[model samples]
Target: MNQASRDVIRPIRADEWPKAKELRLLALKDPVAPIAFLQTYEQAAAEPDSFWREQARESARGTRVRQFVAEGLEEIWSGTVAVLIEDAGSDDAFGGAVLQRQAHIVGVFVRPEYRGSGVIDELFEAAVGWAWSVEEVARVRLYVHEDNARAESFYRRYGFMRSGETVPMKGDPSKEEREMVLDNPQLVSDIS
Candidate 1:
């Protein structure tokens, strides 16, 4: 059987904070973490247990955010992705002003061993599926660092198109991140 078939993709639970924290720390240690994530290993490692618990709790049940994980047969997490709903006229997680009702994909990570095993695709399927379920979401978007060619390529293959928007990488004005978007197919069909 394929790896995707052996694993289950589902939203995280509030009680799984420890696993979530572990996976997040591992992701931060990845070589691409510098460009893949906004936070550093030192910063995340310094946070207390309460912080991780709160993060897991919010992601588990918060109306504005949801985190999904790919769990293997042994209950091991293979990958994770999160979507945060952004309301029009409200501030986004990046401290930017939001111009539309959208879902911002973030915290994407897959265990190195699981790369190319279809786990990432399953994770995105779950994340984007949940994003589309939100009535207020008109589109789903994510930012890929300009230097992260692998991620950018994957996003393109997964049907995200560059929206011609670029934002300066936080704390590194020399680098930039490109915005990619996938409009809601249901909404698109309705318009057509």
Candidate 2:
């Protein structure tokens, strides 16, 4: 396959559970895993195959949830991002009330070699586009570890801004994750 075709970014298929599990495992092994993700490699690796399959199926297709992967040459996934819908009046994973319908981006990771090659840019573009297309989605949001400057910088570059809210990281009271958000660009354009 041609190089251009090798780097396509697209939604994963429901049956691609193995690929999803593989990419997630790889993400957990990254140097920033502890601060970058809430789950440990050991915990995820110990999950049964059925769990992975169910996760893949649920996120593969639906307006409420979506997972996108950047497939590199030879069809290996080089990066992935998942979006979970948070409805208004409901409690978020952090125990905070969800004030608006939003897409909560999670599990973002790109292979080390693909980090500076625009792979992440493409992934965010796709994820944010999907979020905005969904009905009543006011924004897209993600939380980054306070000490993860590199990730925070990229989120800012992608048009997200610190929301001035921080939640204590799970299992670690000393570390906090800061919320960042990107208001729907179409709304910005309309108001301009």
Candidate 3:
């Protein structure tokens, strides 16, 4: 069977900070990291262990944010995605005003060896599914760098459409990131 088929997709536990930090550092070293992520490897690596521990702890709580990981046999982590709940009238991670209650997907990363193995699909499914479970979350969204075609294509295929919104890329105002959104399917069905 394929790795993806055998992998378990679930949220990271508070005690899994070490593993989370390792995976995040690895992601930062990826070739497309420059465009795929806002943080640099050097910056992330410089963070104290407390940072990762708190991050994992908060994500595990699943109250405001959650980080899901794809785990295979022997507890090997293959990928991760984080969802941040944004309340209406609150500022988002990018300092923009959130117009509605929503879930913003971020820090998406899958190991190179697991790409196209269906791991990404599972991760996204879990993230989006959890987002919809939140009360009053009207939609889900993410920002993709204009030059990250691969990520943009995958987001499009996963039912996210361009929202015609753009934001200056963090640390690089000369470049922009495009916003893509996916309305809550449950809400859509209800309206229909």
Candidate 4:
């Protein structure tokens, strides 16, 4: 990849989760953000460094979950994506529902300045690569707020199609979350 391109994508180091957490809080502060993220900045900011460390460790730990960051030469974080593998028969954060083995994508964000610069494509390349690299995963899926058209479009561009599944946001019965899935895990391709 070219310098400009290569400089944008990589895994968040175990030591960098503090910054990772910070940037994530920044992303949550965006205006259209509420519909994009499940957690609020206030909640994330209240977390201690140990919480951040545990999160980072789980992300980098072999397939339990992973976080990838898009950084520029100055090490500015421009984007990020995290994927969590849901084990079969284990209840997810949502409730009693269980999955055999599917990767759940979440915590996706791209800086406004870099939103259309192919930065996300690389970040996703790393994420989907890691997702597919796992053996038991049949697919990778994510939920988007029904009103988040921009994120819906980006997700569609990544080959994620609506699965006709919708769940009420945990605490908000008024809004629904739509599930989108990359049905063909083997088709993950290069960004450029």
Candidate 5:
């Protein structure tokens, strides 16, 4: 079947914790996992069931975080991306101050067979759409590892531009993760 016919992009429900955990573990095992994520398969895989439950619940509706999944044939998830809202001047998870109210996209992963099949684009559309829907969100942003050219290029194509902010990669001080931003042009035009 074609990509569109086989896939559905939607927000993950609180009860879908098992599916969420499974997809994350699979993503961490992919060949490019090292550059794509901050956690290792061992670490994520070792987490308790309660941890997964909490994680899923936190990303459900009514929270500041949301996880969107692309479920392909047979209801299996083919890709996932998560967004976390950050308030301006508040310290981020990495100890850096957020410069503005924005949604931070993270944990992007797509199954190998689904790569380049527009799965990522669909996931991004859902994620960015949610980000823009927030009342105080001025834009959306994400960080790409300096060496992750494939990911960086994808984000660029999605309208995200380098924001000139860099953060040291966790556990890899020599490398950097550059911040990219996509301003809410609709909001900008409205304000003008």
Candidate 6:
């Protein structure tokens, strides 16, 4: 679907490693980057070409993890999200989650201009749809910074509720991150 004449959704190809890396750098440059991303541009850019190549290959076919990107008419990626399959005992970037059959949503980003538009919804539809489509996944979840009210509100609109669970930050152990779980729509759909 085109929004204001912009074709906003597309999957990043395995051959598009360089583009992925570039977009990541742009995301890190944003003012909210410090909280939005776990890694800095300096760390990512410092990686050799091999790292980009491997990232592309993994996201291309890894059932455990997948990346989706939204592009504008200019073919510039405006947003992205990484979905990772986490079984009951899987450990993610945030550490271990004991929720036996769930997926962790991470690496979410949207360009300033694309905020408020359906661009985010489309990206989410793509990610959450993939999560539910997985036969082994029972639910999906994410962690947001307590200080990020905007993100918390967005998650609420998306059917994610605070799980009342908190995990300390991996980098800064003194800080805490809160968990939010996506309501399992299957329960409602199955009833009807």
Q: How does each model score on TM-score? A: 0.97, 0.94, 0.97, 0.90, 0.96, 0.89
Tens digits of per-residue lDDT for model 6 on 87-175?
77766665565657788898898888878777788888889988888876767999987777888899999889998988776576676
| Candidate 4 weakest ten by summed lDDT | 183-192
lDDT of model 5 at residue 130?
Answer: 92
Query: Ten consecutive residues with minimal summed lDDT in candidate 2?
Result: 1-10
Alpha carbon lDDT of residue 97, candidate 5?
A: 85
Which residue pairs in candidate 6 have backbone atoms (N, alpha carbon, C) closer than 3 angstroms, thus clashing? 88-100
Cα lDDT of all candidates, in order?
Answer: 0.93, 0.90, 0.96, 0.82, 0.91, 0.81
Scored against the true structure, residue 60 in model 3 reaches a CA lDDT of 95
For candidate 3, the lDDT comes to 0.96
Question: What lDDT tens digits, residue by residue, belong to model 2 across residues 1-192?
Answer: 333245889998889999999999999999999999999999999999999988988887666789999987688788999999999999998999999999999999998877777888888888998999998888999999999999999999988999999999898989999999999978778779
lDDT of 5: 0.91
Q: Which candidate gets the maximum lDDT versus the true structure? A: 3
How does model 2 score by TM-score?
Answer: 0.94
Better of 1 and 5 by TM-score: 1
Which whole-number lDDT from 0 to 100 does residue 143 have in model 6?
90
Model 5 ranges with Cα > 4 A deviation: none
Ranked by lDDT, top first: 3, 1, 5, 2, 4, 6
Model 3 quality (TM-score) = 0.97
Candidate 4 vs candidate 5: the lDDT winner is 5
What are the per-residue Cα lDDT tens digits for candidate 3 across 39-158? 999999999999999999999999999999999998999999999999999998788899999999999999999999999999999999999999999999999999999999999999
- State the lDDT of candidate 1 residue by residue for 1-192, as single tens digits: 888889999999999999999999999999999999999999999999999999899988858899999999999999999999999999986778999899999999999999999998999998999999998689999999999999999999999999998999998989999999999999999999
